[model samples]
Target: MKLSLAEQMREMDKKAIEHGIPDIVLMENASIKSFYQILDAYGDVSGSLAVCFVGAGNNGGDALAIARHLYNNYCDVFIYMLVPEEKLNPSPKTNFEIIKNMGIPYKFVENDDDFDIEVINEADLIIDGIFGTGLSRKVEGRFKKAIELINDSDAFVVSVDIPSGIKADSGEVMGIAVEADLTPTFALAKPGHFLYPGRIYAKDVRVVDISTPVSVIEEFDPSFVAIDSSQIKLTYRNPTSHKGDFGHLAVVGGSTGKSGAVIMASKAALKSGVGLVSAVIPASINTAFESHLLEAMSYPVDDNGGFFSENSIDSILEFVADKSAVCLGMGLGVTESTKKVVKAVMGIEKPMIIDADGLNCLSFFVDELKNRKAPTIITPHPKEFSRLCGVKTKEVLEKRLELIKEFATNYNCIVVLKMADTLIASPDGKIYINTTGNVGLATGGSGDVLSGMIGAFLAEGYEPLQAAINGVYLHGLAADIATESSISYESLMPSDVIENINKAILSFFEA
Candidate 1:
């Protein structure tokens, strides 16, 4: 299960308390992990000063324990314990006394300027142990000034639990967070570790276990799953399965010069396990697609070259009615006629995939998607999503999960928003963060090939959700496999990726 910061914390606390592990011991666990991590980052310290910024809660307590460790390790570690000793949190109270009793010089600041200049100037390494997950407000007043000092310092800054002032639940920044060079997060990685402004502040990420029970997390059912290479394996077909036994997928798109789009997509579908594939292009380009592609057959429709005309929809629906599964909208340029053709095909109520030009068509008449009367998967990048929602691209990027969930539910479709980390959101609110592919799948026709491959799985009579998850996985796995062989994302073309699909699928089956 994919545990968020809050969920993991709740789970950890319940188990710890149930097992008679006091909150103090848990704090010690956190402190030990933090200290060890710091030592790992910068080890063999001969003589260096570590200035820790301590707050009022457990994070500050963690700082105090770390200070004790540094003292024992022969480093000149000091604490700028900002929260007053009189106002110290219970656990922090115990640790602060321990640090003070150990004879480490600790500074308590009541003024902003005095704290900033002092902490910044005297710091060799700044440890950010201020305001962990308990923070609900912004870092302002005295703390804000201190955070600024930590940010400006040339010292190596290590964040204890998380970067202070970044929401653990959501990745939203609360006022200000300490910009840490390395952040050692407890338990599962927090959303802030990979999401936006918070990610920007956290230069490096490391996950640590504070002795939380694995059984406790079993009870926590997280909706999001980060699909990694370490996850499921997708492998090639067995020797027993031949051309007819696999599956057949029909892709309807491409207008003349844009034939490469349909060609690329069809090739990927075939390579990913479809027994046979056919691209339904304009009647004029049938010979070209058929000639270039031996494994895939080409079925022709109306129009000379540019777009799928309104009159072409009837012939297309009739031609693909008996096909296993259908893929549409790769390089089929947007036109009034093409829109009419798409709407009619969509009306046929067949299991299908809609991407590229297909998504563009939906932006105009979003109502058509209202009643697909059948299952459909829609893959859209940021710009396409912006058009569909009639909002700015930046707005969509900012609230990616919200928009994807809303859009998926509204259209009764599965939404795959392609990004550095692709998000697959189902209509039921289940979201998957694909961790398989590297930046190598960022090329242009990459999306088209993905939709086609997914369509191949759909055509084979697999469950829609399963097909989607598998398709995204295989598409990315192909890129990952290709990348391992020296074909980086920057140099990868759609055609090049087709050869890698079988390898990726086989890898999954073996795993």
Candidate 2:
């Protein structure tokens, strides 16, 4: 399903209403789904206490409707309205009056002084409806205290739509947010439910269908997506095709102490189905790579102070002649000679995966990217991205989507911003979020493995963007598989991920 921002979802809801689905009907459906989800979570509600913190908007109306359902089912329900009954929105006020007529007790608490903490503590389940996706301002006053009370309580919190205080568009916390055990979002999942601090707050999220027609969602056409296995495509190879037909790949970079980076990347490229893999390293340590990389061909490049020298560019260019794609800058340190070498490599028109020290090198020559003719793919973790953009780390993290989009559009390059939730931004304005991966991928050399895998895909004739998306997904899937085998995310190493590449590929096809 296409993951959306607040604006896109609001537009979809508006379109649904315009197409004959009434606002009241959607509310009723939302209440019904939330009721069942609560029942499914806590079994019978015969005499349990359900305290619903209602707001002044449609979200509050949802809680009021849900409260009525709980009251009808013989559960003791209390309504804590944050606004006056007469000040509520039309639909919510209507539901409020109905609940009052039905004899369900409610208290209007506009500030902390009016709220009773003891009453909140007695609840078996708390439904947070204080705010939804439309919340923009920082939460304060009575609403803030109410969220604090709900969180402090031992009750199982079920947030309606989204956890209060999370920005729906960016997944950023607005001051503070309620940590929910279950969030039954209406119609579709928002970016907040999956992005970092917000994702941490929203423990378990389940998308609830509220009768919005599938046609409306399709018509909206949200460009952002969380990739699933169904979208992965590995074309059938010709039965008569030979090793030479699959394409050759080259991995460059690896200084004095960091020769293992290129070795790992080369091994990963070979494991990713590249027909022939070549490892290019410093001449002094060429024997080291040769001994370890039994299947991969090794070439010696000139070096100064254990790093690639500017003079080696000619040899590197010569070596890349027969290669279809190249993965560069794994551990090549940021020295003067290495900078010149990187400049020469970037001048090549071959599809290249620039990563690690390569990204550091590119930061110095970002302006050169506008003049490049080839499709350049740079894989940078948050810090590396920060350096490349010449911004603070916090700025990069806070405005990731915007910065990535602008960089890709301006540079005309495919960018892989590696984070907990990896984002793939294309030059043409498409964005993809990887749905597979675990904490096990947090180890060293994991990014190096990913660079090699993407380079291998580029060699195998995949488009630059698709190559990045597939490589990232498969890399994470391999880590997830490794975690499954060991039943631990901590024990899985980069090599373990490489070992499971075949299994990950098979699983993708099976899926």
Candidate 3:
């Protein structure tokens, strides 16, 4: 599903209201769905204490409406309004009046002391409605205190819309944010719900239909998509097709001690259905490559001190002359000579997937990518991207979406920014966030596997953009599948991910 920005969601809400869906009705639907989700989690809410922290905005209105429902369902509901009743927004004020008429227990928590620790201690569930998606600044004062209290509590938290104090666009925490066990968001999920700090805060997010019509959402034509197998374009093989039909991919890199990088990459390419795959590595590692990779062919490049030197570029070009795609930069030491080789390959005019030291070396010659003959795809984790952008890691993360878009658009290439939520930014301004995979993929050599998979897809004739998107989604899906059979995240290695490639591909077709 396409994730909406905060403004896009507000616009969706407005459009729903304009089309005769009452604001109160949307609030009712959201609260009712949340009530059911609570029931699903806790079995029953009758006589169970639920403390709701309400603010002064429309989100507060959601809390007030929900408070009425919880009371009706026989739950002991306690409403803690962050602002006075008179200061509430019109919708919240309306709901406040209704809840007031119902004689629900409520308090105006306008100060630090009003954030009662005892109340939180007695609650089975906490409803966080202190802030909404429009929140821009850092949380402060009484709200921050309340958020701290919520986080410190042992009770299950259900955040309405988004967790309070989470920046909806970037998923950045605003000083403090509620740690929610479940977040029943209205209409569409926001970027914050999936991005880190925010993803951690919103543990289990469930998107509830609040009667917003599909026509309204499609009007925005959201370009941001959450990656899923359905988006992967898997080309079925014809019975008459030969081995050469799928195209050959050249894997380059693997220095003296890092031969395993190219080996993993080459094997992964073969696993990804590349018709012919070869590893172009330093001749010194030929024995290592030959021993580990039985299905893939190997091309030995002249090695200078056990690493590809400037002289290796000629051998690489000649070797890849007939190859459809090239993957460079796994385990290639960031030596000056190796950088020369990488820079030379950039001008070869083939679909190239660059990673690890390839990305590190390219960081020095980023402008060279624009002059390349064919499309380029770069896979960079946050630290590598930060080095390429010449920004601090935190700054790179804070502006990930912006930086990746700028880099891809400016260089006219595709970027797969590896993060907790892997984002594929295309030159055409489209962004895809990968939702599969787990912490199990946090080990080394995973990026090499990803680059190889992407190269294989490109070799198999997927567009540069689709190749990157498919490769990232499949890479994560493989790890996810690998971990499902008792292979803990700590024990799951990149080779394990490679082992599950076929299963992941078959699952894609099955899905």
lDDT of each: 0.80, 0.87, 0.88
Q: Across residues 10-71, which tens digit of lDDT does each residue of candidate 1 receive? A: 66677877988787887888888877887888775448888888998778888888778877
Tens digit of per-residue lDDT, candidate 2, span 46-142: 7999999999878899999999999999999998999888878888888898998999999989678887788889999898988989999999999
What range of 10 consecutive residues in model 2 has the weakest lDDT sum?
222-231
Q: RMSD (Cα, Å) of candidate 2? A: 2.1
Residue-pair clashes per prediction, in order, are 9, 0, 0
Count of clashing pairs, candidate 3: 0
Give the Å shift of residue 444 in candidate 3.
Answer: 2.0
What is the C-alpha lDDT profile of model 3 across 1-511, one tens digit per residue?
7789988888888889999998888888888888788788766888889999999888889988877888898999998989887788888888989988889988888689987799898899889989998899999999999999998999988898899989998889989899989888888888888877788888778888878987887776675787766688898889999988998999989999999999999989999999999888999999999998899999998999999978878878888878898899999999999999988887787889999999899999888888987988999999999988899999987789999999999989898999879998988887888888899898898988998999999999999888988899889999999999979999999999999999999985675
TM-score of each: 0.85, 0.94, 0.95
Which segments of model 1 are wrong by more than 4 Å? Answer: 5-8, 11-15, 39-48, 115-125, 134-138, 153-156, 174-176, 233-236, 287-294, 348-350, 390-394, 436-443, 457-462, 470-511
List the candidate 2 regions with Cα displacement exceeding 4 Å.
236-238
Error of 2 at 17 (Å): 1.3
Q: After superposition, how far is residue 357 of candidate 3 from its true place, in Å?
A: 1.8
> Model 1: number of clashes?
9
Flag regions of model 3 displaced more than 4 Å. none
Candidate 2, residue 374: Cα displacement in angstroms equals: 2.7
